[model samples]
Target: MHQGDPRDGAVTGLQAGDAVDLGRGTALLGCGGGGQVDHMVHALRVALGADTVPVVPLDGPAHSVIAVGLVGSTTVLEEKTPSGRELPDALAAVERWTGRRADAVVAAQIGGVTGPAAALTAHAAGLPLVDADLVGRATPRIDQLSLFVDPLPTVTAAAVTSSGLRIVVDAPDPRDLETVWREAVSHSGGWAAFAIGPVDAELLAGRAVDGSVTRAVRTGRAAGRARDVEHLAAVSGGRLVARGRVLDVQRGGDAVSFVHGSMAIRDAGTGAVVRVEAGSEWVHCLVDGEPVASTPSCIVVVDARSLRPVSTDRARVGDELAVVVLPGAPWWWAEPHRTDRVAPRAFGIDADPVPEPGQRPARGGVR
Candidate 1:
């Protein structure tokens, strides 16, 4: 089983179980969508093996922790398996470019593959794993990090692959950083490992959601008893809005890194059928052609009978999944302030959606 002493001075070695534990925390922080948990868990197991990788808590002095991860589409990652040395190479590139070495590394954001990817990189780079993350939940873009939102300079970044492909980017603006990173990822089979510059641990602690990893463990533990769809939702405090097998998937464009698919579910007792629409992170969940919760709300796809998770990329025709709808980040309902930039409108939806009856808006607004 995965076991570690977070109190250990620094991250050092790890095993398959440890990766599983860490990845579980990432799923909880994902807030619904990130990627497939099984794939991430397997990746962690293969990357970690018997080596003990130390994970450092996201606390303590500033500038001590570094953020490192991957950039590009999960679609690409699924189709192209990395050599597992991509992250270590990326870290070396960043170090060479910035003339700085990382003491500890962190997952840029909490997601299925991202967390483990960061951990694996940290292990290979001989750096501790930092506990904190840039966002409390998984985000669609790298610039959405608190460090970026605060207008902090990305300063330097590196993209690497075991295929001997490597690139370095130095930009003062996060937007510019994202543009360059996207280009590099596109050039490198649409996925590349990255190691970004360090940030103030104090500032990160002030904003990051604490004990996110532990939370994932709790959620996973609760899921142990989820024998049916209803039990699974109760374990997550979520509601099962739809269930079905995938029919078709449409990825509109590069900008829309989401999966657009439809599903049909059958009533357990009556054999009645229902359909639902799906996207990258579950933009809109429907029941027989009616929208239950659109974008900004979390839509999770779990095994219809087993309650396990299914990633967007891996979801396919004839696969049974239970669509769970849950509340979104509470900050989304706030005014048009900078912090409220994650509203549904931000995703290109034309209208603001009203909250379901008895359900409070993320930030307390009616819509």
Candidate 2:
């Protein structure tokens, strides 16, 4: 493990092997969004080389923690690679805009690429990474973050393209910020590196999902030992709700903001069928046309053979998969408005978000 400053003392850094675990953990948490981490893992490995990337506790003495990740359609990102400098450039831009140096960097969400992207940015900037995140998983919009619901001050944001172009926005309204950032991403050839927030440790302590980074690492390690859904469930709050081979996939309307679609997975033995809806992230899932799991609760599809997650873009016909459902972060359950913001209805599904089996009822009864 790479060590940070002696004054910082004993901080655990992510070794090269941890990248694989982090990637798997993030894919599980992505809820079928957050883009794939295959490229990110390669990037991080090359960037960190023989040294471990330092990770600090969120509660550590950092006065300012900036959230950093890629913004825009994951489909576009696959074709347009980042310049390897976009994140650091955006981080520098955020620092200039905020007039405050980033004391640490935190993942915007614990999804496939974003977590590693944040870690890479922190390493590039020579700052410690916080073992926490704004959202426990990926969401389609900027307004979905717990920090947004907390209405944290808009400390300015920077979006940098792979071409080295940069645009900074200072919108106070989260919704407006999303709109502007999306437009900027569209203009930048559909994706860009985004740096937002200077959320203080004090504010993050109260609002950010604590220990999420560590959870991702743990979940990744568990995945390596997973023999079945039961093993996966033991580590993540995930359960195998359905198993089948994909029969068909129908994409929803094309949007610059997200990749939307629906897919049907049919059981080979029983011929039972389940349909999964996606909006950047998987939003709702149904077994035999009856709601089984919906947004606010994570619905994921994993390869039955390898137990590796299958992103919506990659779910093909004849691929055997286990549909798994996991409980959302505590903040989503605690905040009614937050749940409503990402509810099935928000994704054009008519049903309400459903809780995982044996899980406590969502507060306010699932909007």
lDDT, candidate 1, equals: 0.61
Summarize candidate 2's per-residue lDDT along 157-197 as a digit string, tens digits: 88897656788889878788788877777776888888887
Each model's C-alpha lDDT?
0.61, 0.79
Model 2, which residues run further than 4 Å from truth?
A: 1-11, 254-257, 268-271, 361-367
- Give all TM-scores, in the order shown: 0.77, 0.91
Best prediction by TM-score: 2
Q: Candidate 1 on 1-367: residue-level lDDT in tens?
A: 4454567423334467666656654564454456545566686688667776665566643365667776777666767766777877777777777776667777776556787777677777777676556654566766666566555545677777534678777788877877887776666677777777755577666545444444454455566667788887787667777666655554443343333444556544434455544444545454554556654455667778766666555566677767776555443433334333444444444335545436555453324
Judge candidate 2 against the unseen true structure and give its global Cα lDDT, from 0 to 1.
Answer: 0.79
Error of 1 at 216 (Å): 2.9
Model 1 worst lDDT run, 10 consecutive residues: 331-340
Task: Point out where model 1 deviates above 4 Å.
Answer: 1-15, 24-40, 46-51, 61-63, 244-251, 254-279, 286-297, 313-319, 326-339, 351-367
